[model samples]
Target chain A: MQNEMVAMLLAGGKGTRLFALTKKVAKPAVYYGGKYRIIDFPLSNAAHSGITRVGVLTQYESVALNNYIGNGSHWGIDGNNSVAGILPPRQTDEGASWYQGTADAIYQNLDFLDNQNPEYVLILSGDHIYKMNYAKMLAYHKEHKADLTVAVLNVSLEEASRFGIMNVNDDYSIYEFEEKPKNPKSTLASMGIYIFTYKTLRDALVKDAKNPDSEHDFGKNIIPDLLAKKKRLFAYTFEGYWKDVGTIASLWEANMDLLDPSDPLRLYKDDDFRILSEDARDLPQFIGKNASVKKSIVNQGAIVLGDVSSSVIFKGAIIEEGATVKDSVIMPGAHVSSGAYINHCIVADNVFIDGSRRENEDGKEVILISK
Target chain B: MPHILGLANLHGAPKLGPITERRSIASTSFLGRYAFVDFTLSNFSNSGIDQMGILVEEKLRSLVRHIGNGVVYNANTKRGFCSIMYNEQYAPAPAYNNDINNLIENHWVLDQSNADYIIFAPCHLLYRMDYRDAIKYHIQKKASVTMIYMKCSDGKNSFINMDELKLDENGRVLEIQKNKGAKKNINVSLETYIISRSKLEEFLEFAKDTSHFFSIRDVLSYMTGQLFIHSYEYQGYLRAFTSVEDYYDFSLEFLNPKVLNELFVPEWPIYTRTNDTPPVRYGEEAKVSNSFVANGSIIEGSVKGSIIGRSVIIEKGAKIENCIVMSDAHIGANAKLKNCIIDRYAQVLHCNDLKGDPKKPLIVRERDIV
Candidate 1:
């Protein structure tokens, strides 16, 4: 299977940091922005960037994610010989095994990559939220005459230590790399997006998989080894909204960012990256005579009879009379019955609260999960 | 699969008052997301009957746009066939539009189709049914024609001017009489008929010299005691929007839960063209209750007891009550409305109050700013 360029997405993270949200669901399968899953962003981005040969490597809780990305028709990546496939860890002749680490995972699937025989490989993470045209990065990689290019986004100095920080010269050639340094020298944090010549990536993965001291990782093992060998590594800067929703607080705040009037990640902004989701086949939302809603993103099939401000309500969720919901995220099928008041909380899908009032004012967000 | 040939606009486009002012009733937007013909097409698709022929009359631009390629109903596939038939010489009139002549005009599709039994349907009767079992019932009895009907309790209101069938104990058609608004268990024709290809060929020759014959109903009506027409009782919900009162009543029927379930169910899903509009967004000051708001709508005022279609904007301080606002209609600030049907993209100016009777809905033509 020969292709122009193939995208390999590592979707193996357990996302334990997201707390109860990812207890049974993969991070990518978590609902976001009212209607879409987290994985829709990157898959939509790659499909729109005209890089259609995508293989998503999954390890944990891939059932929902697998069902969602079927045939990729939601993003219009199903025609003209373009295909998207989900690849889970499977048994080989040796034995059934899981993906040990990022580098080792690709190494185990090296034969799969060779089948495609791509000239260049774009490696990406499945957990990040952003809309970018990777075709531009691919072009920059070809023009730089480099063997490896790392896509980096600028983060705040305080947030730099939470990511793999990369230091590059003025000409944009990487000279030093540190995996989450406490006292970082650069604000250019690694987006964990990599593009490499197929041959270079294959050779590096093979060598890294054989090293006992190595961690079999991209930022921890592969990048350091390549830099040690003086491989031509360049940094590709990206300018847009990017957030790693790895924690509960970060995920909660990231959702609130959609309601921020000044935030650039609003879904209605651009037509090119219109994030597509599964059609829930819901009717239009209904607002009652006394319902007062403000500064919210509400989908179809909702019947609201109370006050809702600064929240995101999914389809089919109902807020009854005398109930008030503010600064909350209510999933589909969740019901806030009459006389109930909720604030700064997350009502999971289909969870119903009886006629009572509960407020979260301890500055710590509350998450309600239905049994 | 039965050879499906639907005679669109069983009447013509010029009737139905302002609803069909621009498009035929077959192409009329119904129930927010579907065209009137979609229910009939969905019946064909769900019943595994592809290879359909739709007789196109005047004002079919919106109908053509909605059924473009017919991929939504799987009529755009290589194996599935969706034929839009046209008659170059056929004319349309309100009281005398002949579907039998339209059939004579597009005889080629009927001739080339592989199926032997033909299912002829009119567009106005909205119901959910599987025509397979009915076709089987027709074949089992070896009947020349099977007329599908329902035991409608509320038929007297709209069918008063139309004809109803009187069936005997054996379910055979006995008599045809004008519905006089006196019966409770009136047998209303659902406008669906199953006849073999040979019988259709015989009717084509029979109707060749009869320019006065309008539909198969015309022939069957006159030969009530002579012809062996069987009646198949359809126990589902049926509403014929032939009159403006029927249309307004049917539009508000979705507010009832039982009617909604009978009209739309998951097993027999209604297929329609999918629009690429965003979800409805409710502003902070918006107050909405007991309404069906479609996708891409923005609400900032109060709405009660209404159906708002796609891309509608209800501006601040506006109050819409018992109104059916179609797609892209704008209810300007403080425009109180009651009992009206706002056409697509029509705007009601600021602070304007409009009202109509519950039996008749006031219509605003498409794209007209009031």
Candidate 2:
């Protein structure tokens, strides 16, 4: 059976907030919770939600992400009918340019959408670490008879001012949409996920491309224009744990969220949210006789000979004989030598720490980006 | 890549009792993560021998599910394929279900494959082997069959039902006899054979002319005095799991650092069906010492000298020592378990005490709920 909707994932963000981690890899390729890349959440969500076709739009440094999601067999999206394609920006008769905005990213790939001829198009960002059944949102879009549907969350009014607030009536009809408004009347914040009727999205993109004084962005330009035209743009209220992991604080907090056994966003607990990742293909985690691990998650290929407390250790990471790692994320192949004590830190991939106790006194995680 | 054929022989007893009650020996979960077939399949894939067939005589479902088109193994390419061969005429009758008919049923895989050498392997023995060198030796010797064997010695070699090869000084097989419990080091055939396809076809024809019910091993045993059999001595570590005791002993052997490193070398990787299970999480009170815990398990209590499988929950105050706890087997709070083989999804209730002999571990059946 053919799928009703196709998805376009915007994964080209440089994620400058990530400091050293993003120096080489794209934001979507960043490893999280010791087992998964950030993009696995959305891809798993889409797979579980039964979105058969996905066009992963990539820009920036995308080699890792490209190879990881190449055939998409990891997420079960590489079947005969289903396809997961990597859409990179290319030079054409129209000209060569990187993805300008979220809308422009889709606009450049209208040829792909035209080939699929889907009834609806789902738009997502690659930086968020959350599991959402987009099919349910698509159903809500169908029920409302809406041309566009934007996933919204009920955030606090204070936090809502920082997000794109949607002014929805009691019946859940979005009347006004404002990006980062000072005087916010509603707390329905946009999650940056949108579902649009294929025809409506095609017309909007074509119209927005020719317009002057436009950013070619969904939040800044296209969404407001849809509201001005009085189109049916319903706000789909999502009640679940979701995080835009675009910053170090949120990324660290997201990993910490998986530490709690009772956390709603528990990485391994829920059967519904199976966040699939690529295979590590390494041996099991080995805890040495002297190892004392408490309240931590350690991945495959990790050999822990020291003390670990409240940390997430990725594949091939090591804690030397007497080292102590607490409240830290040790990325893949990272090492902590003997007598090295690291607390509340994010050790980037392949990093080495030795002989010194390092702690960020700023009360935030010390970002140790590898060189 | 050389042509490869798989004999999913029901020859090995799938009698780990409750553990093997459902699946064949090939599909039995090993080392908390992989199946027995994964070792052989990974060896085949890593060796660049992609074209192969699995002759399923019995318990085909689990093996089929585990392999599924063989995409993860990189065996489902356009250049090669992993085919499941079944003999409908002989699968039901246990007496007729042998390697000879399996080859006869899937002879097309051998007939169509565009290769000169064929690596016929079984799943009972677990080891990492590069068959290229063995194939080179077979080519150089100009022998019809190059039999693979290792000098295997464990305390309980009596349970091992491998064929012992008697060789001359030139490494030519002089005689072959079924092992009758060798106490010390003995050459045990690993059931890995490399031969030319034409020679294999000739052997198949020779065995067919004798009897319809003649087994492949029976024919090979008879032909040992006639055929030019060269022996390929495998010097690496090998464990032939023929009985429950052998399974337990072999599993515990992985606890040794030297054996563990040798089995799981970085150069030759063992691939299996990858689960999206998150990394294993250790609780605040968890006191783990000298253990190998696979990903997706959450350990809380005291685990010493054990191997824990994926998605297991070891509750607080429970103590596990010298045990192999399979996936989803929950040990409740305050439960004490030692020298046990807890099967998949089995539960040892809160505060229960269970202990088995160090030599023969107690088997908790799958989803036993004890």
Candidate 3:
């Protein structure tokens, strides 16, 4: 097996379910937790996994996404050997149109994979939060001599129908795959993470492109077609805090999970799954004499004068005297005025809650009071 | 003549004002590697002004820590480099209001050194300006009060207006237009000015004697023609983060290399207490191209043309492009975020997709949910 592998990031989805949060920005650009966007996870994972050459397939709202991913310099994906570019829809001999499906998105950007001549192509979705070593997955794929490998995780049987369900033999070879079947064959669900030999992926993409009846999706089209050809496919089990925060409720729940002091999704721990990001010039947090805080994660540059409990306060936030904030996530420099009460809310950056206010009593409404 | 004591409102504006409302002004902010209040303190210190006192509304703990002994700005000596001056009540009070007269009285008590010249400066603004030059301009013209003014396109939004500049032959201001709509051109006040210490003392005495509420702006307006109230121009960048929008705008401006050079240039260093964090580390899957990341960060994502802060985590499969993420943020795996502002210690859950407009970015405040 070669040390070099090409990773294709599927970032073209519209992410319509994210609602108003993704109205202006792409779904990936939507903020999560206290101070991060959904896209940071996959990008950081790729960097940590040591797969330098990356290709991001972008479509909706690609302009901002392109500008953000300019040559992928921040992630150390630069130089002649590394290729990081936004592959938007282009007019070709096949026909001029936007990406019809996931397979099509990758098929159109085949040139990027060809130029790299990587032994393996790691195809992954741009949304999903988990930490795994792709190098280890690649080693698994090579050791099995499998033509293709899909990362599978055990989801609840009730929710298995929502994903691409896979049945594996004792040897770990995938025996069957069903897309959103009414009755899922097994609880094992494909996480939309796949590693395929360069040739196998290229052939599958080419065949799928020629099929007029195909929807061009991996589960809907390519995987079924590959199975008919008896192509070797294996399932690799992944155990971690993996989630698809596609809807508002799911996104909210994921954030709530971090509030647990002992939550398994700890990003601050210096362990194998530590989350990595860029460094900014942030100052140390200041807790005032009047400030009474407990069981909270307060970052640098935060000034707390009021009462904070079970909350996460970002840097440069000012909680004025007489204010009470509980079970909330306050962004940097957000001002909670005197007598303002915030409970179970995620306050956006620079949001100013005027004097003497009550918000988020219901817990379902995420208050966004822009200043 | 009224003596003017200029005090910078150092505690008024937090990075994100809402987060700091109940917090004291002494508290630190996202600029931990640099103290946000240091700019104003250094300006006053370098001006060689004696007997200066800092008026802190609240959040004094972190502020005191950063300005420990005032050693860095040389305000901790026998001469009183910098002192945390608050509103002293004849009787115990509920809360302190930022009244101009109360501030004036505080200055009077601290003026045991008997420094005749008084200036009031605010700490909420970002600028490396010289007060000595403005003071010189005030003295040369024998003006009773000289307010620092910056050119503004539309004059209606400013706290004070100087449409008419009555300057001497040497361009010294003699009079200022006070009435609104007097002229379309606006010369906004930078909220710092020089005043005769005795004149300010007189105003304070009058307010105290009558037990009347007096404001600095009201005094300036009342004695406009009687005293030689004039205006001085400031040429450099001066921004006050009075609102959340302002804070976001000013922070993003640092992404521009020109703005970074102008602000952090060696000739005028913006001093702040430093944090000792390890240098930024980049992994192989990390595809960072044409971006500026500070120290103490670990990049493992696909970041392009972005500005990231210390101790940030970009998980694999996550693609962050054209965004500004502050310190200690964690990006979940396979999430896609574009053209956004992520405040400190934020986490983007796995497989979340966020995209912001090119012009209007989606700003995620500290400790917030996406």
RMSD of each: 3.9, 2.2, 19.9
In model 2, what is the error at residue B57, expressed in angstroms? 4.0
Tens digits of lDDT, candidate 2, B1-370: 4455543344534466667877888888888788888888788888887776776767888888888877666645787777777777788887777777878877787777777887767787778888888888888999988999887675244425568888899999888777777557667887888878788788789878987777766777788888899999998877777777778878877877888988888888888888888889888899998888998888999998898988899999999999999888999999999999999899999438899998889889888888
For all candidates in order, the CA lDDT equals: 0.78, 0.84, 0.68
For residues A302-343, could you state the per-residue lDDT of candidate 1 as single tens digits?
767788888888877999988988888888888999988788
Point out where model 2 deviates above 4 Å. Answer: A356-365, B1-10, B152-161, B180-185
lDDT of 2 at B252: 74
Clashing pairs in 1: A284-B293, A287-B288, A287-B289, A288-B288, A288-B289, A293-B284, A294-B284
Full-model lDDT, candidate 1: 0.78
| Highest-TM-score candidate | 2
* DockQ values of all predictions: 0.46, 0.80, 0.03
Residues A1-371, model 3: lDDT tens digits:
32368899888777887655555557666555545567767776776788888888888877767776777755556654667777888888967899899999999989888888888999988777776778888889999998899999999989988988998898989989988778887888999999999899999999889989999998888887878889999999988778888876676567666655455564655345445433333533444445565555555545567887767676657888789988777766788998999987767667889876898778666544444
Q: For candidate 2, list the clashing residue pairs, or say none.
A: none
Per-residue C-alpha lDDT of model 3 across residues B1-370, encoded as one tens digit per residue: 2222335565333445544543443343434255456777667765665345677655566567766656455543565456666655621342333445456646544456455677866666667787877887787778777877776655555433223344555444555555274455656566676877777677667655654444565556556666667778887776656555555556656645467556554445444544334334444455654355554465567776566776777777789887777778888888888877777777888438888886667767677756
Model 1 agreement with the true structure over B279-362: per-residue lDDT tens digits: 566666777776777776777788888888877889888988888888889999888898999998899994388888887778
Report clashes for each candidate as comma-separated counts: 7, 0, 143
* C-alpha lDDT (0 to 100) for residue B289 of candidate 3: 47
Per-candidate chain B TM: 0.92, 0.93, 0.77
Error of 2 at A4 (Å): 1.8
